[model samples]
Target: MKILILGAGQVGSSLAKYLGSDDENDITIIDKDEANLSSLQRHLDIKTVCGHASYPNILEEAGIKEMDMVIAVTKSDEGNMLACQMAHTLYQVDKKVARVRTAEYLHRKELFSDSAIPIDFIITPEGLVTDYIKRVVEEPGAEQVFEFENGLVQLVETRAYAGTPIVGHPIKELHEHLPKIHMRIVSLYRNGKAIPAYGDTVIKDGDRVYFVTKKSSVSKVLKEFRRLDKAYRNIIIAGGGHIGLNLAKHLEKNHRVRIIELDKERVIEIAE
Candidate 1:
């Protein structure tokens, strides 16, 4: 697959690293900074183009016409959207993904369509991060949680603590411990090394355990691995940025939330 990624900032560079590592993907990244391009070239086996990513000539230079997918992750939402529009209208690129941060543009659903902006997908980092934090908070003992199968199934990662009922016990014993609950241990990691999750394999303290279970039973499954934390009530956020504000809004309905920002103007705006 030939992928053209616009912008060489943190998200773009990180995507390049992952996509370039795959043997099948031919990745080319674009940015206005020569230094960032140079740094990326030395680290990854991918092509780099330096210019205004939204420009037609720049897209042509980056081989957008032949690209299987185009991802615009530039810092500016307008720039990203323009690049995606150009990719679709000028180059007829099939797959277009853009990172749109501002809610004003994102809230207007009519702007993103085949007849309008032509963005195939929109990636909202702030919204994704907020949802992730909400999942973590909901699952008291889980370090990471991923939902699949229309939210009916979930893959959860949590550390096996000493006080946990299942710690230092064989994997098969889970059935005996929680006879009513249904879960499966998929993998185990100890000291950054993969360990087979065999039925006879005993879970140990400090082991990073990965399991799959029904989403409705996630809380019950988690308690088997670690001590359940008390339900969160009072919360304090350090910044009133996009992520902080979104989190506060989500938690305000169920939990007491307060936000503190260094900028007085931003604080006052959030307070309102």
Candidate 2:
């Protein structure tokens, strides 16, 4: 795949490193810092263009027209958005992804439509991490939680302790134990090795089990694994930065959340 990446900061350099390592991908990176570009060019096989990322002439020089996808991760949110917009409007790039940090633009989703900015995907690093942490907190006892179908379904990882309902039984008995609840044991890991979960496969104690089930039945299914942790009704988080604020907003609806920040100005911002 041919790709054009904007910015050569940590995010851009890291992306170039991974993509350039793969022979199938052709990566071209843009940045205003000649030093940053030069350093990356030394280590990676990617082509480097030194200029303001959002500039029309610079984007053209970086071969945006012929590239398959464009990714904008410049420090300036406006620059990232504009580069993605131009990549779509002028170059007709099929995929345009921008690292947007500004919450104002993110709240107004209509701005990213084809009729507006034309960005195909938006990457908010803080927001993404916030949601992941939120899920881990919400789904107690789950070693890991992966959401799909807009959180309608969840793939959960939990340890099967001794005395847990089905720990000594075959996989087929899972449904027999809970006749009404529909659940599937997708995979199991025992003693650092993957154990294939089949109909006759027995779920042994100390096995790390992965299962897929409806979102609403998650807690109910968790009960069959081990004792569920008490639901988190009150949460106190340190700092009020992007991740903290975003987490508070998501949890405040159902959780009694309190934020402690030393910065008075940021506290006022959170109040807003």
Candidate 3:
């Protein structure tokens, strides 16, 4: 696949390092900074274009027309959107992905729907990280939450707490206890190896269980199993950088977000 990535910052550089090395993929990166392009050139074999990516001519010169995928990760959402729009409408790229920061775009998710434009995916790292933090903070015991298809399907992670009803029971009893629940113990992570759960799989203390189930039945399943607990409300985040700023912006409306940073200038900026 021929992939064109805009921007050469940390995200774009790391992406080039990982995705550019794939033997089956061809990666091309574009940035306005010569220094960033030079640094990326030293480490990767992918093609680099040093120019303002927001311009259509630069994108055309970078061969966006022939690209299999176009990824716009520029700092500015306006720039990213302009580049993506050009790639989609002019170049007719197959897959287009953009990294957006503006909260308005995220809030109006219907704008990013498949039928809207040529964009295939919108990766809001800040929003994703904030959502992740909320899940973990709310369910302190849960290590992860894998939502599929806009929360239609879910894979929830929970640890076996001490004194739980299933602490001394075997995995087989779960089926008998909740016969009506449509859930599955897809796999178990023990000692770093994934083991398939069976009737004889003993539910030992401190054992981690990965449960896959429908989204609507999550609360009921947890309630029936007596594993439901209210998630924590207090959250303390340390930093006020771009990532921190984006996170706090999204969470401040609903969560008590407090940012801590060492930079005096940034501290004052945040305070203002």
lDDT of 2 at 1: 95
The parts of candidate 1 lying over 4 Å away from their true place are 22-25, 42-46, 108-110, 161-164, 167-169, 189-194, 204-207
Superposed by TM-score, candidate 2 places the C-alpha of residue 96 at a distance from the truth, in angstroms, of 1.7
lDDT of each: 0.92, 0.90, 0.78
Query: Residue 242 deviation, candidate 1, in Å?
Result: 2.1
Query: TM-score of each candidate?
Result: 0.85, 0.91, 0.80
Determine the backbone clash count of candidate 1.
0
- Residue-wise C-alpha lDDT for candidate 1, range 1-272, written one tens digit per residue: 99999999999999999999999999999999999999999989999999999989988999998999999999999999999888888889999999998878978999999999999899998999988888787787888998898778989999998978888899999999889888999999999999999999999999999999998998888888889888888999888999999899888998899998999999888889
Q: Candidate 1, residue 204: CA error in Å?
A: 4.4
Clashes of each: 0, 0, 1
For candidate 3, give the lDDT of residue 52. Answer: 92
Tens digit of lDDT per residue, candidate 3, span 103-217?
7677786776445645788878877787776555544445787778886777887666556666677777777777888898776766666666887887666667788888776
The digit string of per-residue lDDT tens for model 2 on 74-140 reads 8999999999889888889999999998788899988989999989889899988898889988988
Please state the error at residue 71 of candidate 3 in Å: 1.1
